[model samples]
Target: MDEQQLSAAQLAEAGLDDWRQILGRLKARFRTGDPATGFALANAIGQAAAAANHYPDLTLTGADVVVTVSSPDGPGITRRDADLAGEISRLAARLGATPDAGGLTQLELGLDTAAGTRLGPYYAALLGGEVTDGEPVDRSGQVPTVWWQDPSEDNDGPALPAQPFEQRWHFDVWVGHDEGERRLSAVLNAGGRLVSDAAAPAYWVVEDADGNRSCICTPTGR
Candidate 1:
C-alpha cells in the first residue's frame, strides 16, 4: 500500500528488493564509476553508518550504489534516516557535488523555471546538504564531488547522468512537521493547485506547474 506498508518479501516481489534489504533503512540510490569515487562512497557509507551507529542497505548496481536506511522505523521522521541524510549531505559537500540539470529520475527530476532548482535545494534539505554559493548541493556519494556531467568530466567523477534508465536516481522524501505546511502554503500561495481525491484529507497530492506530484502528509500513523 505505502512505502513502508509492504512486507519485506512482497517488496521484493515488486522488484523493490532494495527497500526490503534496507528494511527500516530509508534508501538512497547513486550512480558513478570512478574507482576513487566508489571507494570514497563506500568509505562515506561506512563512516556515516558507523558514526551514526546505524547501518544501511547498500547495493552496488554496475557503476552505482544504492543505499537504503534502516532506522527511524517510525512513520514520518526516523532519527537514523535524518542523521544519515545529514551525513551524506556533508560527504557530498566535502566532495564538491554541485547541482546539475542532467538526467534524474522522473520522481526527483522536475522542470521548474529554476535550473537545478527544486532538486538541488529539495535534496539538499532532504539530505541535509550544506550551502555553496547560495545554492545547496552534494556529490552523488562519489568522492571529489565534481560535475562529472559530460563524458569529458574528471575520471574520478560521475558519468554525467546514467543513461538508459530502468532504475535511475531515486530516493524517498519525507515531509516533516511545520515544514510540510509551510511548503504546502507556499505552493498554494504561488498558485500550485492541490490534487484532491488523490488520497483525500489524510494524504494530499499536490502538483507543480509541470504536473509532478508531491504529497502533503500528516505522518501521524498514516
Candidate 2:
C-alpha cells in the first residue's frame, strides 16, 4: 500500500502524543542514562529499522540517543515515518529510555530565484552537495538541504504583478512553534530585527544589522 502523507494538523496531533514535529521530520530523544545503554538502545532501533525497511537519523551522545525519521523523498512527514516512529518509541520504552522532546533542531536552506536550474549547479559544487534532477540536496545530511523557490503566480487577476526582488538566500531555522518566541527574543537581543511575522506558526523572517536574513520556522500548522 502507498503511504499517505499526513497533513500538518494530523502530523501535529500524531507527533504530540510522543515525538515532536520539527520541519520535515519527527524527532524524539531517548535518555539512556549511559553510553552502553544508549548503544544498546541504538542497536534495538537499528533492528527495528531493518524490519520495517525504514531508517531514521540516529545520534548517540553520552546519555542520550536522538532519533529522527522522515520521508526519504518528499517535503514532510509521511505515513511510513509516523509508523516507524511509533515502533521506535515502543522499543525505547522497553529499554527504559525516557523521551526528551527538546534535544534537536532541523535546518533547511532556501534559495530564491527564477533561474534555479542555472544556479543550482554552482551551489551544489560549492557545498559539495548533490544535484538530483536539478534539485540540490545534502545526501550526507550533515548540512541543511537547499531548496530553490520561484516567484508564485498571482491568480487573483489577469495581470500577474512581479514579486519585488529580495535577498536570494536564507536559512530556515526550524524550532517548535512554542519555542519560537524564546528564540526570537534571543535573536533580537543579539541585534536582529523581525522583518515579518505575517506568517506566524510557519515562519518569521528576521534580519541582522547588515541586512542578512534568515527565518525562524515551525511546521505550517499550529
Top candidate (lDDT)? 2
Q: Kindly give the number of clashing pairs for every candidate.
A: 11, 0
Give the runs in model 1 whose Cα sits over 4 Å from its true position: 1-25, 33-35, 72-76, 96-222
Query: Over the stretch 49-74, how does candidate 2's per-residue lDDT look in tens digits?
Result: 99989989898999999888987786
Error of 1 at 163 (Å): 36
lDDT of 1 at 189: 92
Top candidate (TM-score): 2
Residue 198 miss distance in model 1 (angstroms): 4.3
Badly placed stretches (over 4 Å) of model 2 are 12-16, 150-167
**Candidate 2: C-alpha lDDT:** 0.78
lDDT values of the candidates? 0.45, 0.78
TM-score of each: 0.34, 0.79
